[model samples]
Target: MLPTLDARLTAAAELVLPGKPVADIGCDHGKLTAVLAASGKYPRVIGADLRPGPLAKAEQTLEHAGCKDRVELRLGDGLSVLSAGEVGTIVLAGVSAQTTWEIIEQAPWVSQVGGPRLVMVPATRHSELRRWLWEHGFALAADRPVQAAGRWYAVMAAEYTGEVRIPTFTECLFGRTAEWPEGAGYAAWQKAKLPRFRLGVPDGTELAEEIDKLLDGSPSQTR
Candidate 1:
């Protein structure tokens, strides 16, 4: 039997394009990797982690799922485990936006044209991550709002478009998720954080006000 992925991982998995290989980075328990391998949609599957302990756990997951031969487990930091173009889609989850950006930045090839698609579920700072991706020559191709474990999360799928531009604050916060089914809940969750956020940043007050208008049912014009 294949491992059942949680709501977040299930959304991440759905964003992966078919036909090419996929890699699950920071695959803590390797449940997602095993599930992908068992699906047999992709020709190859890889599960990589920066730590030995997690990689070991992933190995066991593949074994128990009876898909050990279909998935390759690698031990390395971020994208270092695979060469550029080795996979068509890359999944990064269970990490903060800062850490996710650090990993992607270290792998310059991911920003190249025709690079693999990125499906990321940042544990925090979704706005910061969206803005970083836009300014760094990537575009938010797709996004979905997933409510799991009583909290809302955004699954961002981005691709290297080489169109480096600064996104508006609303665009950063909402990305392309406003039209999604669970977008309202995700927006509400983000809005609830503004007060605390306002306490820390210099422009937090203005930023909060701007987002407030959008969250008030005013349609956002984000790209």
Candidate 2:
């Protein structure tokens, strides 16, 4: 039997481009890793975790899937387990936005020309992650909204563009997902969190008003 992925992981996997090696960073049970390897799309598949327990579970998952020899499991922190250009796609799932940013930030090579693609599913702070990526020279190539276990999540695929720009609050919140089938639910979920996000910012009032107009079906001034 092959490993199976939930709706969230399935969306992440779909965003992966073919023809190059792929790495599942923080690969907990390696279900996604096993699936990727079984697909035979990429030349190589790697599963890396920071802890021994998760990596062990990942090993078991790969073994059961009969693709154990197809995946390389590494024990290391973040992207340190692999060298630059080793993989063309890097997956970071089931982690907080802050944690994902920290991992990508540490691996500057992913921002260089011809860097690997990034497929991320941030457990929290999705808007913040989009903004961070935009300001750091990474561009959101695409995004898909998916619901799993009764919660809506966005799976974003980004690539290094080396063009840093300030994104509007609305753009940060939406991130090319406004047209997806589950986009409305994800947007509403993000809208509900704006109140808390506004509490600590200096331009809270303006930002909140702008985001409100955009989310309320008003024509957005900024894309």
- Separately for all candidates shown, the number of backbone clashes (residues 3 or more apart, or on different chains) is 0, 0
In model 2, residue pairs whose N, Cα or C atoms come closer than 3 Å (at least 3 residues apart or on different chains), thus clashing, are none
Q: List lDDT for all candidates, in order.
A: 0.88, 0.88
Instruction: Write model 1 residue lDDT over 98-185, tens digit each, in one string.
Output: 9999999999999998999999999888889999999999988788889888878889999999999978888887788877878877
Model 2 per-residue lDDT tens digits across residues 1-223: 7976899999999999899999999999999999999999999999999999999999999999999999999999999998998999999999999999999989888889689999999998888999999999998888888899998888999999899999888887778887687877877777777667666656557876785565467434233
Q: What are the models' TM-scores?
A: 0.92, 0.92
Query: Candidate 2 lDDT (Cα, whole model)?
Result: 0.88
Q: All predictions: root-mean-square deviation over Cα? A: 2.1, 2.1
Question: In candidate 1, which residue pairs clash?
Answer: none
